[model samples]
Target: MFNDRPFPVDAFPKIIRNAIYEVEQHTQAPQGLIAASVLGVISLACQNRIDVCRLNNLRSPVSLFLLTLAESGERKSTVDKLLMKPLYQLEENLFEKYTHDLTIWKNDEAIFNIEKKALMLKLKSDIQRNKDYFATNEKLKDLLQSPPKAPVRFKLIFNDATPAAIKDHLCGYWRSVGIMSDEAGAIFNGYTLNELPFINKMWDGATFSVERKSEPEKLIRNARLTLALMVQPDVFKGYLQRKGEAAKGIGFFARCLICQPDSTQGSRKISSPVVSSEHLPVFHQRLMEIVNDNITLDNKNDRLCLRFSLEAENRWIEFYNKVESDMGFFGSLSNCKDYASKVAENMARVASLLHYFNGNDGDIPLSAIEDAVKITTWYVNEYIHLFSKPNEFTLAITEGDELYWWIKNHCNRHVVPYITKNTILQYGPNKFRNRSKANELLNMLQSQNKILIGKRGKTTLIAIANLKPAI
Candidate 1:
């Protein structure tokens, strides 16, 4: 089944595909088991090293928001730990190194504060006595010059965090970090989910103003936030039931690469877990290299530039035009046109991610751009399935229409002028559990002039009108 898909696991980079294959050997999950995991690694790998090269005179940040829908027992957390282990190790190493520096800095700050307080006192005394205060003020200025700065607990990834906390962390990390959560509910249902405006702006690499009472307004520039969220289908469904339209309306889900692959619960079998080999170590090592690769942030705190080849540029132009065509009148993606319009940008970002993962130099390869397009196509289909409404009919309404069609076909197949209530309860396409539903459906059909419901000898009957399905 995965082999037949447009973007199969095999289409991923060799290192990523190898890692996914190794993990699947232990978990026995779906073929796309590591789809979100790969994105998680990319989120951290591309955090500071690269951005999507300009394509068709347009460029977008390589940061991505990804969601993989599965069930509770899909080993999502195990996969997360495996992919993020290198990041955790880096965090530990940084903590140990920063601990000593922070202590020394704190001692220097204490001495500096003591000297500053003494100078302030002396200056006040001199001013009150009408004495020469300029000399004392000069001493104070010298004492306060070049205040000590404590080391920050730099982090590569965060799991559960509020938007306000995320803002502060971004500032600490120079406005570049990745958010990875095995459970999406932690973020979707958190207190800061209401910070949608800030979240949206950051995702688009727009400046966001962080207001504070004590400090001046901070304008965060070139904020790149990469996210990889995994959620059970039912939890995501619940989120949709409550905040689906609102989330989509604000372009939250529109910026995501969502995949609801078939579950691999009942089919999973016990197996020996594979030990870490050079194959997996190489990928992890590369990711750590990116983490340690000193990124030269510009005045805007933006990462290094990533350029594309001429052929890749042309391919993006063709892809952009195709997407633009569908964002107009009577187009299939008119409802979610905002998402459709960003297809080219998303492709560029994906290509850059692949380019970095492959350890490539110079312009991005055409093969990477093509693969990105395929992945984006799958994302478009998933988005339509989730958000797009056709002819004012929601998925529920369309499904109800389908049920009505099945009933009509069932009656015609038996050549029965009327479909009995007992027959519908027992053998109808839906196998309705109660007669009330059948009665209400019959009433609706009667109003549409498709059927007539009548009672005959204490048994309810549905009389077919026009002898054709309403759909």
Candidate 2:
């Protein structure tokens, strides 16, 4: 059974919950969309500074990959802009500093080049005159060895980039970055998704070599990347239609926390006063604090590793076993075992994020783990709802019910002995627009004696077998 439930907003930390609520009240977007945007920011802010220790004593980055599916006009961009304010502010500050540092570095490099040329000339003249050249040679060596270092330009967010560009940035510039977009057409529709395998390695925090044609092979290690894409349903569907099998085969989608929230398009009214002013400032302030702290840590190449308490470890083990059992042949999640297998790890990662964001120290507590489970369980059901395939019998019954209701409503309103098949195909349910599916449903309904099918002068007609009209 696939369940479509509301997001478990209360399960999040108070800071995160406040931000989600503020965004929801202001934008009136789906709660899930707001929550996803908030979580993406948290992942970006925390990935560089924190690592989590699993039960096996293995360390993993607290990064996350979130994929949100919604229709157009869902206010995804609005919510993301509100949530990502801190990150944008941080990037602006970094760009300003980089501009100043780059100017100084360029001047230093020019001076070093001028001095080195003078030293080389002195060494050549000394050598030609058969004078003592050791002093000039030593000067040249010292100057060459002491060239000014280039400043690191810290960029934290990327909207559109290829895998090669991503690796280059990580290898040369910043070790932590996020790839986020509210409208993700370029990510899914362009060539970015062709490197799913490489992206998968980034999510796993695994080291891999980037072999280049002209440059040396760059080994990408200890690099952290967070992916958060909010795309409309049709774009994602097209990607799935074309490359879903390959993506699944490589376990790329398994690492994602995917959701398709119900759209809140028409119900959003503009009656209430904006209240995000109350909560979003606090959220943004705290986020900037975290990001600034992480920037310091990143420069020092230091990270804080969090571990679970004894009680929390036991609870996590139990939860892991439960998720693993659910992937068995007779279990509810058997259809999506790939996602099921990783849900527990993702739960742990979420717990780590919550724990760190709340300024908790020492070990992660049981309460955080419990809260994370509530959130991840909802995501598990969402994955099944979006990806699970229905059997023929079940699909037939579902579509049959839809067709029956449309026919019953149409017949009750019109005082006609019969309705033409053309009318049903044209004005009926969209799913039954195909002639073959409509004919199959008509035959099934006729066999059940629910409808009578006949011909009226070259037109096929359908009538309710026992019809009644309400007064």
Q: Which candidate comes out best when scored by lDDT?
A: 2
Query: Over the stretch 278-385, how does candidate 1's per-residue lDDT look in tens digits?
Result: 566777877777777734334244466678788888888888888888888888788888788667777788888888878888888788888888777877876676
Q: Using Cα atoms with residue i matched to residue i, what is each candidate's TM-score against the true structure?
A: 0.77, 0.83
Best by TM-score: 2
TM-score of 1: 0.77
Candidate 2, superposed: residue stretches over 4 Å from native:
274-276, 298-300, 390-471
lDDT of 2 at 403: 67
For candidate 1, which ten residues in a row score worst on lDDT? 390-399
Model 1 CA deviation exceeding 4 Å by range: 1-7, 55-57, 96-100, 123-138, 270-276, 294-302, 328-332, 389-471
Which 10 consecutive residues of model 2 have the lowest summed lDDT? Answer: 389-398
- Candidate 2, 280-399: lDDT as tens digits: 888788788888887665455767889999999999999999988888999988988988888988999999999998778889999999999998898888787677753321222357
